[model samples]
Target chain A: MNVLEIQGLTKKFGNFVAVDNMTLNVKEGEIFGFLGSNGAGKSTTINMISSLLQPSAGEIRILGKDSRKHSRHAKTNLGIVPQDLAIYDDMTAYENVAFFAGLYGLRGKLLKERTEEALEFVGLGDRAKSRPSTFSGGMKRRLNIACAIAHKPSLIIMDEPTVGIDPQSRNYILESVKKLNESGCTVIYTSHYMEEVEEICSRVAIVDHGKIIADGTKEQLKAIITDVKDLSIELKPGSAYSLQSIGKIPGVRAVNEKEGRLSIQSDAAVDNLNRILKSLMDGGAEVKALQEEEPNLETVFLTLTGRSLRDQ
Target chain B: MNVIQIAFKEMLLSFRNRRTLFFMLAFPLVLMLVLGTALANAFSTTAAMDTVRVLVQDQSSGAAQQGFAGFRAEMEKSGFAFTDFKPGMDGAAEVEKNNYDDYAVVTNSGIKLYGSDRNAVASNMTQGMLSAYADRYNAAAAIGAADPAKAATAFQPAPSGGYVKELSLDLDRMPGSMDYYAVALTVMIALWGAMSAANLVNSEIRQGTAARLVAAPVRKGEIFAGKVLGNLAVNMLCVLVVITFSKVVYHAYWGDNLPLVLLVLLSVVVLSTSLGLALSYLLKSSASGGLISLAVQLASFFGGAYFPLGVVEKNSLLGIAASLSPIRWANMALNNMIYLGDSTQVIQTIGLNAGLAALLLAASAYMMSKREGL
Candidate 1:
């Protein structure tokens, strides 16, 4: 069964459309990666799905319940870790989690048990009594996640949970996301880091200009751009070179030169590498190094959107 | 249950914020101490006038002279300097020549007091003393007519250090300086709760925590109600602490009607909280705190929190402004209850305050509902 489904979703702010005709589905227990450039409507869509924002058009179904008509039912099973640090700095970590947990209807021994378990889950059990203001950045991020998941919701939506943090904390969060999914919790993970998405997400969707441009498994997405390969050839400093004939190479898609480096894109790198090199050598270019690039998620995004994801 | 939890959490957060806690609790206490002492000194200085000089001219002979002599002795005992005018001297002319505060003309009918308007306090005190003396004498004469033995024992000229014979009408006692200021500062500081409420509401929104609560299963109404309840609890605690501290430390009288005083104070808390809530909805989070502070300061100034309303009431515009202040009504009602044992004004002010609070809350709720993407 699908844990979350959004169809024909749209959000508009004044005359500007933040999310346009967005639609997707997340199967239970799958780590669904939601990728987008900055201001690409990813947060807007997540906000709508989590009931923090009202969609201008269309519907959202959470665990087979219409979100608008049955918000409580939908919200009861959903947890959202917002992009911003939403934990209270004045409250102890335990108090913060317990407060949010209580809001989800937990009480008595169960409430205490869940609160402790959530703190333990985030590796903050020993520091539960410490306020977030005294915590390190990584610890605060962990506490933020603890507050959202203390109720043990069926689906957890994390928006850029690792945007700005140390490498260790980022890795810990990535591992935690994997563990959450393994424990039968469907996760919607949004991040600007394409590598993080590629590592943990079982399936991914790339949203740009408020529309999903690509959706599939990592390998499936890579396969779409697999026909193209980037060949980088570095020439000696001040070596003269021309691409008048190189552009005519069979299977070569595009050519760009910067400084003493020439980059060649071709449909068949292996088939066209030999000829392209010979043409470059014949053009009086002293080649210092030659390398062929393999296809990855970043390349896939670049191929589909004609721009680097990081640039946006 | 959710509202309680939310309120509890908000209260916890507020307590943990040391700066806000200091402003809420300690600031008012310190202001009460400083202002209460200063205003008390000013009032006592005014009340402690050495003597009021009066020029007395006897315009009647025979029995009236005896009456004037009796009245003159009583005035002398009560800290009045009397200068008897000779037959040809004009009493009013003598008062002006000697720069006396006032003069009196004793006739067969009654005594007439004349004084400048600048020294109204001294003038009023002199008038009251003369009236009390005349009333006592008239009562004594009536008793002498009815029973000679009783009049001789009960209605002799009052001894030098004793009060005059009792009059039929009771006099209203004015509140002392400390008592007046205690009530004024209490009302002023209680209204600061409105700013506290505004800060509490705006902080959550500014910090982005409000959006997190919104995403929870709780309804928006529950969230607003929880915040208001939490703010009210904290503010009421601060106000009670200030009130109790003033009563115990400064020996300020809150009046005999303890229950009624508490009820009216609670109404003030509600009004303040509602004002804060309404301001939170009307202004930006960053701007609301300063605006609330400014509003409370202005209200206190016009409401007679710092000085007597008489200082401003002489000006028509200021008088109207003072009358419109909630703090003015609260101060007057509390003063009446404490000094006069009157509850009529107390009940009216409470009703007005409660009604205004309800209106503000309604407006706040409507504004909250109308807000988009909150």
Candidate 2:
């Protein structure tokens, strides 16, 4: 079942549309990636979904409840970890988690247990008594997540949860996201860092100028650009090689040699790397090093948007 | 439940803030001490007074002469210099010209006292003494007509110290400087909670924490009410601390109607917090704190926080300014309740505060609802 469904969701600030006719569905148990650069309407869409911004038009449903008509029910099932730190600096980590959890209607021993569980889940159980003022940036981010997830909502929206943290904490947050998805909680993760989205997102959507320009799995998104792959091989100096034979290999579109190095372009769909190497060996070519330039999400993004994500 | 949780969180944050603590507790306490100590003579009825010069018109014949002499002797002891009335002397004109503090006419039937309004406090005291002397003389004559035995003793004169008693406080005791400022500073500082409420609301939006709150299941009204209640709790705690400190340390008299006094103070807190919330919503959050602070300062000044409202003449610019301030209303209500056992303004004060608070809260709620973004 889809945990969240937004149809024709539009939010306009006066004459300018911050989110224009956006439509999306986040199914249960999938980690959905929402990728966009600054001023790309990504935060605006996330805010509308989280009920922080009322849509100028359109509808949002969370866990089968209309977000506007049944806001409490919708919000009760949704968790939002904003990009900025929402935890209070003066409050202890435990108090911060407990306070937010209490707002979700958790109480008594259950509240205490859930608060502790959330702190432990975030890997800050030992520092539960410590205030956020003493926490590192990464720990604060973890605590921010803990505050959102303590109520065990059906869907969690994490907006740039790992923006400026150490690699270790980034990795920890990534692993935590995976763990949360594994436990049957759907997640909508937004980030400017394409690699983070590329690593964990089961399905991805690229938004630009208040609208989604592309939406699919990473592989599918990459497939939107082209199916060509470039392979380069460096040979030993003055090694014997049959350039014509290497070019004649099936799925090899073109081949060129420069300074004892052969650059080959081939269809990305074909698995001809081993055959190419075997043919090179048979041709008496001594391969010193081999390199392949495969397409990544960044390449797909750049090819589709005509600019780097960070540039915007 | 969410409202309460949010309120609790707000209270926690407020209590932890050092600046809020200073304004709420330390600032009021210190201000009360300084103002109360520095202005003690202003509120003191026991302070030494200048001798009041009275020109008496001795129009009575021999029958009232001895009685007049006894009255004159008693008035002389209590800082009064009696000047015998002379022929063709205009006592009223002389008193008006500041040559004498008062003029009196002693006749066979009674003595009429005319006092200058410039020195109203001293004039009122002298009038009370003359009235008491007349009552004694009449009683002595009444006794002489009824029976001759007690006439001489009654007409001779009562003890010297009994003439100038504190009759003005027959209903309740007067408040001293410490007591006055204890109420003044308490009301003023309680009104300062407007800034606290503004900061509480603005900080959430400015710090980006409000998005989380807006995302929660709670309604915007809950958040607003939670903040008001939380800030009110913190401010009331500070006020109580100031009150206790003044009452215990300086022996400031808060009177017997503490519950009513606190009720008046609670209204002040409510109004102040609501004002803060309303202003924060009506204006931009960035400028709301500064505006509210400025308003609180201005109100404190014109509301007689630094001095008694009596210092400002009625219907004058300062008096009109003081009347416009909620602080003045609250201060007047509390003062009346404390020193005069008057609950008349208590109802009006609470009504006005509560009414203003209701309006502000409503406006804030409307603004919150109309707000496009969190």
Candidate 3:
């Protein structure tokens, strides 16, 4: 069964469309990644699916139940960890989780047990009594996750849960996401960090301009530009280089230069690297270092949109 | 169940916030103590030196009129000044013109005291003095009649040669400044519960926790209900504490009807919570606190929360505006219950407040539902 199914989802603020004709599905127990630049309608789509927003046009089905018509039933099976630190600053970590968990109808022994379990799962057992105001940013992030999952929802949507945290906490969050997925919870994760998505998400969708520009597994997305490899060469300062000559090189797809570094994109890096380097030397370039780069999600995003994902 | 959970959590958050606790609890109590004590001292000092002027209209014939002279001398000794009012004079008109505090008509039947409602204190004092003087004269007359020689030495002509009939005015005791302000401040600060409710709603929205709340299995209306109930509980608790503290420390009278006073205050809480909910929807989250504060001040000003309603009623526009303030009705109802033990207006005021609360809650619920985002 699909955990979430969003079909032709659209949201408009006045005449401006925020999410346009978006369609997607998440299978049960898979870590699905939602990738987008800032204001790319990622949060908007998440809000619509979480039922926090009324879509201008769309049908969001959570666990095969229409989210709009049966929102309570749909919500009971879903949990949302917002991108922002949504935990109550005045409340203790335990209280924050328990309060949110109680809203899901857990009570008495079950409520206490689950609240503690969630805190412990996030490795915040020792700090459960401390208020979020006294917590470090990373501890607060973990508490944020605990509040969402305390109810043990089948499907948890995490919107950049690891944004602005230490490496240890980020890794812990990533591991927790994996553990949650393993325990039969389907996950929908959104983040600006492409590597986190690539690391955990089994399937991914890239949203841009309020539309899904690309969707596939990590390998499949990378395969869209499988022929392309990025070549970076460090040359001595003020060394002359010829862009026109590099652009004319066989198998070279694109060429650009900045700050004494020559970046060359080629369909076959091994075939064209020697020739590219030879041309650079012929142009009076003194090579300081040379390296070949493999295509990742960032490269695929750059290839598909012709711009850096972070720039937007 | 969801409403209770929401309310409980919100209450915990509110209690944990020291600033909210201070504003909702400590600020009002301190203000009540300082203002109530200061005003009470001022009123008591004034009352000590204040004299009630009575115009005596003597109607007894011949030597019997000597009683008026004795009565005037006795009243003058008791912080009362007497004026001679001739027959057929409009004593009521004179009182209206502020010529005398009250007027006494000394006829053969009895002594009648007349005063406007505003001169209730002076009128009662005058009546009491005249009654004591009559009693003294009657006692002396009885002694003289029993023994002729003793009567010659001890007997005095009866004051005004008449019995003291009745004071033709309501003799309800005036509330001391402390009593007046304890109720007034309670009513005014209780209205701040509306601000507390508004602040709670705004904080949830501003902090993004409201989004999580919205995403929960609870309905939007449940969330609204929870927030309002939470605010109401906290506000009512603060009010109860203030009321008890004032009564204990300042010896403030909260009315003889315990159940009724509580009922009236409960209604105030309802009105305040609904008002807060309405304001939250009407203003931005960041601006709601300031706007709510301004609203409470404006309501207190127009509603006679700081002074007598008469002060505002003197102005035509202000009188009409004051009539719209729930605070005005609540405070008046409380005063009536406390000073006069009158329940006639209490029910009406409670009904008006409850009705207003219902309307405001309805409007708030509609607006909350219409709001698409947190």
Candidate 4:
């Protein structure tokens, strides 16, 4: 069963549309990647799904119940780790987790047990008595996650949870996300780092200008740009390459040369590299080094949106 | 249950903040001590004296005039000045206009003294002196009618010591400076609760915790009420400490009705906290804190919180300003209960505070519902 579903979700701030005509669904136990740059309506969509914002026109279903009609039920089933660090600095790590968990009606021994479990899950069990004011940025971010998950919601939304952290902490968070998904909690993770999304997300959706431009598995998303291959050839100093000659070659779709290096996009089905290299040598270009590039999410995003995923 | 949790968390945060503790508790106690000691003379009713100016309208002749001549001569030595009332002059009006401290009408039937309410201490002192003289006069007349020999002997030698007993008509017992400031600073500190309350929701928003809160299963109303309850509890605790400390340390008189005084103070705290919540919604920014602080300071200044306005003329500019402050309404109620033994203003003051609090809560709720951002 799908743990979350959104149908034609629309959100507007006066004349500006923050999220427009968006529809999505996350099946049970799937790690969904919600990819977008800053101000790409990613946060707005997450906010709407989390019920922090009311949609202008759309329906959001959490755990198969209409989110608006069954707000408490929907909220009870969902957890959101906001982009900003929301934990209180004045409160100890344990109190911060327990307090937020208690808001969901957790009580007494069960609340304490769950709060401890959450702290342990975030690797802050030993530091539970310490306040966040004395915590490092990575520890605070982990605590932010711990606060959200202590209630044991069915689905969790983690938005840029590892934005600015060391590689060790980032890996730990990524591993935690995987562990959480393994434990039957569906996750929707958003980040500007394509590699993070590429590493763990089973399904992906790329949002731009308040709409999803693409959605699928990493392999499937890469398949969209798989019809062409990207070629990069490094030339010796004083070497020259002719863009017009390379364009004339069969299966060579596009060609560009910059600073003694030639970049060519050609049909993957054709044997065009030899002809392209011959055209480059004919233009007095001495090839120093050459490489055949494979398409990744970055290339896929650039191909689909005509811009990099990091572009605002 | 969520409300209780939120309230407890709020209380924990408030207590952990040492700065807030100092402002709410220590600041008011120090203010009370400083003002109480500095303005001690201003609050004393018996020690501060002005000459009693009496306007006499003699409507009788013979023995009445003879008695007045003797009374005036004796009173002149002890801070009494007499003026004869002309035929067309209004003795009572002269006293009302403060042209004379007390106006006397001596007639064939009896003598009547009129005093203004503006200067109760002096008026009561004058009234006590005249009452004594009338008592002696009546005794002398009765004795002359019954036994002329005894009357002649009494008239030959007038009594000297303990003739006039001073009594306070302003209050059951007039409050000194310490007593006045004890009540004033307690209520003033209660009003400062508004400063803390103004940050209750805005801080949540600024810190981004509001998003997490809004996402929780609890209703927004519960969160708001829980936070307000916590803030009210802290403020009430601070106010009680001030009250008890002043009463025990400075020996301030809070009168016999302690519970009623507490009720008035609780209402003020509720009003101030609700005002802060309303202001937070209205301003929706960090600037709201500064605005609330400024507003509380102004109210404290104009409400006789720093000094007693007992001697201020009712129609003066200062009195008008004092009357406009909500703190003044509370002070008046407390003063009435403490000094005049009246609880009528207690009901009105609580009614006013509760009514304003309800309106503010309503406005805050409306604004919160309409607010687009957290």
Best-fitting candidate, scored by TM-score: 3
DockQ metric for all predictions: 0.53, 0.50, 0.63, 0.56
Ranking by lDDT: 4, 2, 3, 1
Using TM-score as the measure, name the better of candidate 2 and candidate 3: 3
* Candidate 2 ranges beyond 4 A from true positions: A227-290, B47-172
C-alpha-based local distance difference test score of model 4: 0.88
| TM-scores for every predicted model | 0.79, 0.76, 0.80, 0.79
Q: Model 1: clashing residue pairs?
A: none
For residues B1-374, could you state the per-residue lDDT of candidate 1 as single tens digits?
99888888877877777876687678766776777677666665234686898877778775457766866786687688888777777767655665777888877677898876766777788888889867876776678779867765544566665665666454355566777777887788778888878876677766667767878899888988998898878777777887888799878888788778888878888999999889888885668778988888888999988888755644588888888788898988888788778789999999999999999999998887776445
Q: Candidate 1: where are CA atoms >4 Å away?
A: A231-290, B45-173, B311-315
lDDT of 3: 0.84
Q: CA shift at B265, candidate 4, in angstroms?
A: 0.8
Could you tell me how far off, in angstroms, the CA of residue A137 lies in candidate 4 after the best superposition?
0.6
Residue A78 C-alpha lDDT in model 2: 89
Per-residue error for B7 in candidate 1, Å, reads: 1.0
Candidate 3 on A1-312: residue-level lDDT in tens? 888898999999999999999999899978999888888899899989888889999899988989889988998898989988888888889989999999999999999999999999999999989989998888988999999999999999999899899999999999999999999899999988888988999998988889999998998898888668988889999888789998998887667677888777777534877788889889898999989887778778777766666566
Error of 2 at A122 (Å): 1.1
TM-scores of chain A across candidates = 0.85, 0.81, 0.87, 0.84
